[model samples]
Target chain A: MNAPPITTASAESPALPNRFDLTAAIKDGLKTALIMLGLSIPILAYKTDQSGGDLWLSPRWGLVAILCALVFGLRILLHAFMATKAAREATPSPHQATEFVHAEPNAFQKTSRFAIPFFLGVALAFPVIIYFIQGGLNESRYWVDLGILILTYVMLGWGLNIVVGLAGLLDLGYVAFYAVGAYSYALLSTTFGLSFWICLPLAGILAGFWGMILGFPVLRLRGDYLAIVTLAFGEIIRLVLINWTDLTNGGAGISSIPRATFFGLPFTSGEGGFAQTFGLEFNGMHRIIFLYYLILALALLTNFVTMRLRKLPVGRAWEALREDEIACRSLGINTTNVKLTAFAIGAMFGGFAGSFFAVRQGFVSPESFNFLESAIILAIVVLGGMGSQIGVAIAAIVLVGGPEILRNLTFLQAVFGSGFDPNEYRLLLFGAGMVAMMVWRPRGLISERSPTVILKERKAISGSLVKEGHG
Target chain B: MRWIQDPLLDVQHLTMRFGGLVAINDLSFKVGRGDITALIGPNGAGKTTVFNCITGFYKPTEGLIAMRKPDGSNLLLERLPGNSINWKAKVARTFQNIRLFSGMTLLENLLVAQHNPLMLSSGYTFLGILGLGGYRTAEKEAIEKAKFWLEKTRLIDRADDPAGDLPYGDQRRLEIARAMCTDPLLLCLDEPAAGLNPRESLELNNLLLSIRKDHGTSLLLIEHDMSVVMEISDHVVVLDYGTKIADGTPSEVKSDPRVIAAYLGVDDEEVEQVEAEIGV
Candidate 1:
């Protein structure tokens, strides 16, 4: 019925046994080896001591040669194998070539329903399980700290999900509100001598107010333009913090910020301390445990509020705005208010997380709020699937907690030699994972969404049915 | 056709210019209350422009658009912001191309149309978030209203389906249903029957006629389908080259020489006949 097929692969080019040419392999290896040497010169060739007192030149010529040899060997082997395989399968079978592109998922999808709840159970039991496994709170502090860090991102991801995921507004300066919250709490606590609890809500409100301020002019902008403006807003806030020395203390930041107390009772070793009030001996572990639960409760609150908001009128308005801004306007939804509300609510959560971050660390710095932090939070949202709350949590654990997990893998040194630090390669893996995820599941790890409003039983809508928005 | 003595919507010397190009030039017309007014012309003849201006999608370069409501209040539509027209002036519109909140469910699409009311009831989401009884009652009423429209549009079965997943005909119906949920005094439909098959067009005509008959909604539509326009429209306004050529009942406008000449692409002699028929 159609045009005749062109020459098949076997008829076009027959594979020969002499595919392994040593000379070509050596040429490719030499070129790659030279490029690696040129690239690694600055980073690997010279090293300065932490104190800037000593300098040394260390050459890894042997390792470079070994890596080059491995690359060359792998390339040649792959070429030969691929060539032979191609010749064998030259005559394409109709059945083999014509499977539907969007067929049902094979193995992984079948297990996802079980996997989600299993992971949730694990997350809920994480701290207690670790406490028992490590035999006491002392040994579990590191894991608890890591848990706190991951939950913070999960909260941030869920918060930003409301704006970027549901509302379809790409906000790159999310960290600015985070900074606002952190500073608000820091300044409130230090100057006015307020407690963390009082400063927390105040910080969130201040951050949300700032969110509306920034949201006003940029609400008219869509897609990449919105992203660029938000990114600039984030950088502007950072720059302001750096230049304004009196209020922010410039680069020095506000240090020695007061820690959060258990209600009015402090966690210190004094008479009115939490442990002292309870008639228990003051163990520093109490503070660590308290902070973990505090952040956990905050994160859960973020999740709960987000989930509830999804069913509200404003939440539906956000999703509608994301789908079609023109349609939204035609429906009499004030696009300005919808977009501003998204920014404010998302910023509110970020503010909450930031204040917690301040109380947790007992310090605030300009360094904490940066572009990289925003990117990482955005990465978590994107990798999680924009609108899925559970997806964001899992992505946080995998992306944020994954790198920390790598830090503990000391056995990696035996494989790549002692100089190899896994922490340095965390970003490399992050980039690779993001690229891989785009190719594999462009919608995200959890793409299917349960519609917030439904009739009868709720059905999970496929990601293909949803708009990813301008972002 | 019998009509109200006073025009519900009055457009005076409406002119829309986009830089050097004039889209609508000194256009003037009147749409009577509770009347189905069809705006028809050849493509690029500014049929949709009039609808856009009346619906506040575009502010005419020079015009006074006044809408006399049932309460005897007059609204200057052009003075209002685009989004506010739906709420303040009670004017809702459907796009030439279907623009349902495609990502949302059919019911959700209708609910979004009632956003202003629901938003107010929820105290701008503050009360809604707190799960107050007042917000719940408002939400329930909104859902009931959405269900009523869904039933009217014959899309009650597919109410839970994502609007984008609906068939083309249902999407058209859903767009109308969604607009109806907004409870507009005047519904501006931009080619609601554009892509529909014969049966769907018939359904659309019935739906629109029912809207006017049962709900007392005054419709100002931009239509390309002559059959639908002739069969249903109480009044027809014809435009050519951004200017109104004929304005009267369907038969009067249909037989007008200017509309025939514009559609047939006639020469100078026909143009004179058009000018004579228009008495300009």
Candidate 2:
């Protein structure tokens, strides 16, 4: 077979202006502005009931028109500057494309690394900041609930990252483990009258056991076939949950499930409850705060463990397996063990999150663990940058937490009127954002940083040099 | 001098069949310890098939492939899984087509070759994941070993570069270095000089000789380059139509009438005439 054209080397040559020049940025900005403007026009016109009004001068369209015009003007200016810069640079004669472009972190890479942690930290502290500023301790329950949701998804994203990102296993039905954890907690807690903490690890163990069972059959398969089997396994779990009506309570779901108590003390109006035991005033917000902290700790622990694993031999094996299974085997890596470990670890974390979900919500049902849950988790991993901890967290926030935050945007009602619901279009925006990100950066928002072993003499040669086989 | 000792790799009555077609029919050979054995053959001669069988890439339909391990134990290669074949059996191999991890760095590629060593140090522990003291020592040792091979292969300067970015000849050499980093008892190289220029081919020959002499590694190489085979190989095994036609010292194999006829495509009647003319 003829050698594939090497595109990365040519793109990296010093003679050629970087493709990420101002022109590209301007073009990108214009594209985003145009799309936003296009959607805004229809919504604004419809909301304002200005079908026959003048297109540009109408009060209904004034702000959007100005924004679109300003965006276009700025794009043109940026493109002009970039074009002038490119014209001044000397071009090299063409040569055989032998160089590779291994991905190295450029100037923008450091910014992204900083951005992810900063963004997550901000999101995590958002509720506390709001609580102090607004004195919303009375309404702290909703903020606490939001925090729990964010932390749960964050944990789930990290879990799925192990299977899909590190091992390159495409699991479309990861929610099965979540279901297992939730059900395990629900069944055991309700039947034995066990506390949430007792059932938590048990739930994780049960899910991990199920993960290994599924892993065994699909060990021999790869790519699409493995994905299909895992998908079916997920369906099977969901089906069992639906069909096992006597135990699960079927579609109706188990309600009035015992709320998780703080140690042995219940958070209730009773004399011997948590508030009375501690000699503190009774408030439902305290319970919300407690659940929030619990989930947060769990999420942090999951991140810490996953991060540690990535540096280990097992983690490296997973990456190698992802890149090329045959090569991994040749390197004396037991791919079966690698695959199984990834599944077990990923499912174990999923179980942890699932049990947390059950305890926090005080309910468990098949509806909670559907195909959509898998998609959202996978989307978080992909959109956040595969195998990236901070990226997954960021993606979960923007995709899951972003929509919820939009619910409190009281000002949007002034423009679109009370008839407009921002939440309805949040998904559409989320999808568009994903597509845009994919097109702009196929490697996700934050590409993995290679483990640096050698410090170079020259001004740290571009990763492209390494990618081209120069190393 | 140790040629009288039992061969490090002993393949007896080796046969491989693909459905109705017999690819290798009762091929038997011995690759002596610390000797470079070259396998040469015409197109579709199944030289690579033999290498694949020896490396456990493919199981022979019928035969015995017993490779001596460093610990003085016999490893039935065909019975072991491909991954374990490299680790436990200590038999490393390079493909005809370069199989270097293209996306990984040069150092990373070499470290990957020392997969078993690092795995042992890690003890597959959570502490290893944290790059703890034990893991750090392993990492240092792995880097040292990788650097050693890189310097030997004249790629130390490009240690931080990507494996795929190297020129074609360098990639071929890097593949060798990667295999050697495993510290295997037997190194199987499939057409090491296939696409290299004369200079690179000479470098490859020196590399192979050094590996055999300095490292005491036995070689089972498949090469179409007669120059490399004749120059470095102590023993030559020629395969024609998946059957062993000749096996002897380089001089003996080069003088063999069957090998000459196979290469020159002499007819049955002309074989006698050609042999008489060549005074073989």
Candidate 3:
């Protein structure tokens, strides 16, 4: 490799490209094969099983050998591909081929402009589409249930996006606010007999209050310290719900919480029910349809308000704070209050989604509000490409709906074995998917950043240009 | 050098100590209203320490840092809390290392600097989101102010480009443009010409001069560039080892024996010798 390049350079006309070196390529492949052999030996070569006091060894050296050989071949192919790519790049094209006079709209930009409204239209007509396809509300129960689940996660993802995405605050305990909302609706409607509509706002306000309480102490902390304190705050909320038997009923949970009504109309079999008031045939799907629409509306509310706020002075302050705190203070923006407002608003939306969860489930418990749920929601916010609403919605559908779809894949049991469950491997697949996502597209799916407030013509910028890497 | 006796700012016995290493000792100086005051010192001379104290980034261990208005009212700057030094007291500052919101556009940087007034009219974010006319008009006016500054800085064409993507000279100008958007009474710039080429450095001096002439905004800047400091400054305050060694007109301070000795790394007795040897 060194001799060929030197000879070409000394010739004064280095026209020939650096030829691919087969020996070097073989050397690289051998190294990869060695590493794979070492890894596959422990993880794949042998498996042990013990039944009643007897142990059995199952050897799979053949599988390990095949994998190592496959990796070695793939390494050589990759080297050849990369070498050709470099040669092509080194051969300069015409000036017009590379020079860009000005930036034109990219493929991502054009597709994104179409993707948002298209997804929204689908979301709007989702229940009706399901009703027509399943033939009736009675038969489409599973699909509608899946829709509700996806929308709920979508709502939660948007709420967390405000804090972790826009303001650039790493809040690992966002689910605590969700729990606060759920518990607030559960307690208020159950203990006081308040209607769901009345308790909804109260739940959101209470959650916002809790958000401020969490915000005050953590104002001075940033990055990892901020995340740790927030994580602790979430755990404390969960523990309190578990131990305080007087309010939360301890581990037994609160059940038969009041159902979310259709405004003043009930979804009942008797008169004055939603079906009866409309004179439509009595069906259980009315409630499902209403719940589907309810969550869709709530999620849209979160998205719109957040988008609008991004154009406001307060919203600009949030982004500025994310960029640089010292710059924010020097500009006369009160960073303390700015951070607190972010917490309050984000938690308020979380609370709204939480109340919706309580109504949909008719139950509230500490089990529903755990650290894992917070981690999942935060993952969705990041994986959706922070500060991008459409990205979050797409991420929510993939992360949430993907597993739900797997639960319905009964064919997997027959192919693998009768005892095999595909859901068991969901986490493994999810981990692999996230790893692939990070390696290939580190800035989530749609990483284009446009100014929230444009003074002149709007221009698209690369997302990582301003991305806060602390989280 | 033209100046006013009734200083717009008065610093009395300002002492800022970080443990045993006093970053700023019992130092005192005044900035005249509608005048450019240049603070010059060698490395570790606490020029930036004085800036941090005035901007409320640091609290002095002992001192009175006051800002006076022509109406006979004064604000004790060191007594002011965080961000209020800029928000309420109208003392905006730039950094030695550029600190623009690199991800934000040039126009957004200016708009963010006008946050205090915009925050109020937007009803602390609620009314603004409602798309009310009052907030919209205020936002529009704020944009006009931003555009004004952008025009002055000659950066209006690429106003939408991210601040970090700009050339070095443009980034420095954008920082000043951002601070000016606050409509500040006093603008403090740390090394405004540190990284600029000679031509760009001359342009920055003109910008600072125009800001003082047209807006009546006082400026205090720390600069190693003698051309910039000596060209535009009305008053000069020199520091060494956190203590004020010379304070007067730029010409007088430039020739001060103590300042020459401090900068030349010579003892006071050997200052004359060094000055003769260097042919200054």
Candidate 4:
């Protein structure tokens, strides 16, 4: 398909065309469809055979798919030729507009003045909208599972955003807190036969305690040294989980673990099961839906608390510390207390999410909380935009939820033949998307909001007029 | 001799060392209430070092920097950490290389200087995040204070502009405005006129004079420009090799043979020329 016109000049440039047609969009769409169809047929045929179905549909449809693919491919080549010819025929124009970049926003252009209300409205209405639409209420177990997954990552993203985003502290081993929370809940609940509710706070407290423990050694360290220490701390937590067999279940994992009950009612078909006791029909989806709402609530609470903390003096202190440590110190702000509070609070949230994870899975394993988990969570925070609550939620949805949505594309299997699985290429696509996002928006989806101070006359100022450092 | 009131800041035997080199050695000076004292020296005379030591940037090996507050409470600045020095002593300062929060607007930079006051108004409550009631009031007050300084510094028109984007002269004035927003009792300035043109320097002189006239805030300055020193300073102290060589009024220090020797790089020949130049 033909590429879009570069349109390199600014909006005011006289060289710009009056209107550029998006006619190539249709051809591009057709090309993509044909390519996918050409690749999916054999794979669908193989799957059909494995499921004991007709064999002829695969080969017959494959030929037709290839033929259409060839036609689209030739069209793409022709379009490219036409685009180059058109470009060469056009005369060069030179009326470029001057672009002005501002370092800071004006009082009138303050981001917080608008963003706080916008995000709060979204957070408040999201559950109501989901309920009205009956989202996850009648869906298969996987839909509810997907909801839980999104919530889990959302909480983790918020937690990690505090450490890495708000504080400008790169934590490569944040999963250590997750592990500490999960294992604490698992060990305590199982050993004492306690319920999930009671153990949850205990687990979070334990994780927060460990965060302080970790914070002490890295107090004087910054940047790379702090990252390495946190990474080692995570490894230490994982190693202990693996080596300490008596306390934990070792590599075997705590299987046949008790699933979290709904207000003490199990989902089983027993006398005390939720379905039987409530006179409702038994469906595994009920349990999944319950877990989904449970996690969604927790995630919302995490976001709410984080948002509140950020507006406080401590929150501003954290931001100031992030911007310039020397300045923060000169202002009489205690850097040590600020750093410790951030670590503890961030870890506490992680622990809450981890405890919820253990209850949701009904099993705890060291393998689940690995370096990759830490990396993925960190990526979510970075990609979402640091120091932004809503950005983390949006990023989690795209990064974690995107792969699951891709799994439902059965049409891709038909085009790729028997050997190709779309899941295998999900990470490759994810990596490419990340690269594209970085190039397109280096400051992440939402840039830092400028602080508003009341001017004598309260005159509005445009953000572009201000000059502030981006980083 | 008019003793005036007690010195707002008293520095005794202030010594700072960087390994083998002594940046400030046994330096003693007293800045009287509402006095604009100039610490003048040749380059590398450790004028800025003394400022740093007094501001708690560098801990002196042996010294007592007692800042007498309006309430007559003494704050031993040397014993406090760098962060606590600002709050306890109410001593504000400006850097030779202006360190305004570049990404913040001119008004926001000023308000940030009042961070402690705003925190107190909020009672450090989480409800402050919602910006309800009291927090809103405090925020409004902060803005008013910021605007007051902006007007004072003649930056009201560009209050919403980012501080870093301002013209060089405006940035220097904004730095002073930011420091003033802290409501400090004493202001320490390090080479505020280093890069300013003649007109800008005159404006700065006017601003500093107005500050002393209106706020009654004592000024401690380290400057190389003899014009600035002789123009505004009530008293001048000359240093050579981290030791004080002369301390008196600008005219008295200007006439001191020792001060002349330190500036002219001569023991005898240049001294006569220095006296002639000062009309002494």
Q: What number of clashing residue pairs does each candidate have, in the order they appear?
A: 0, 14, 0, 16
* Native-to-model Cα distance after best TM-score fit, residue B51 in candidate 4, in Å: 1.7
Best lDDT goes to which candidate? 3
Per-residue lDDT for A54-76 in model 4, tens only?
45322456556666667676666
Candidate 3 on A83-201: residue-level lDDT in tens? 88888887777865566323344566778878888999999988889889989778889899999999999999999988888899999999999999999999998999999999889
Q: Rank the candidates by DockQ, best first.
A: 3, 1, 2, 4
Instruction: State which candidate, 2 or 4, has the greater lDDT.
Output: 2
Which stretches of candidate 3 lie above 4 Å from their native place?
A1-20, A31-65, A81-105, A409-421, A469-471, B1-4, B267-280
Lowest summed-lDDT stretch of 10 residues in model 4 chain A?
A: A462-471
Question: Best candidate, DockQ-wise?
Answer: 3
Model 2 segments beyond 4 Å from truth?
A1-103, A116-120, A263-265, A269-273, A276-279, A416-418, A452-471, B1-4, B70-72, B126-133, B267-280
lDDT of 4 by residue, B93-143 (tens): 888887766655687677667778777777665457666648777877778
Ranking by lDDT: 3, 1, 2, 4
Worst 10 residues of 2 chain A by lDDT: A462-471
Q: Model 3, B271: alpha-carbon shift in Å?
A: 5.2
TM-score of each: 0.87, 0.83, 0.92, 0.78
Candidate 2 per-residue lDDT, tens place, B135-233, comes to 788888888888888999999988877666688999998989988888888999999999999988998899899988899999989999999999999
* Model 1 chain A worst lDDT run, 10 consecutive residues: A100-109
Docking quality (DockQ) for each candidate: 0.45, 0.40, 0.64, 0.26
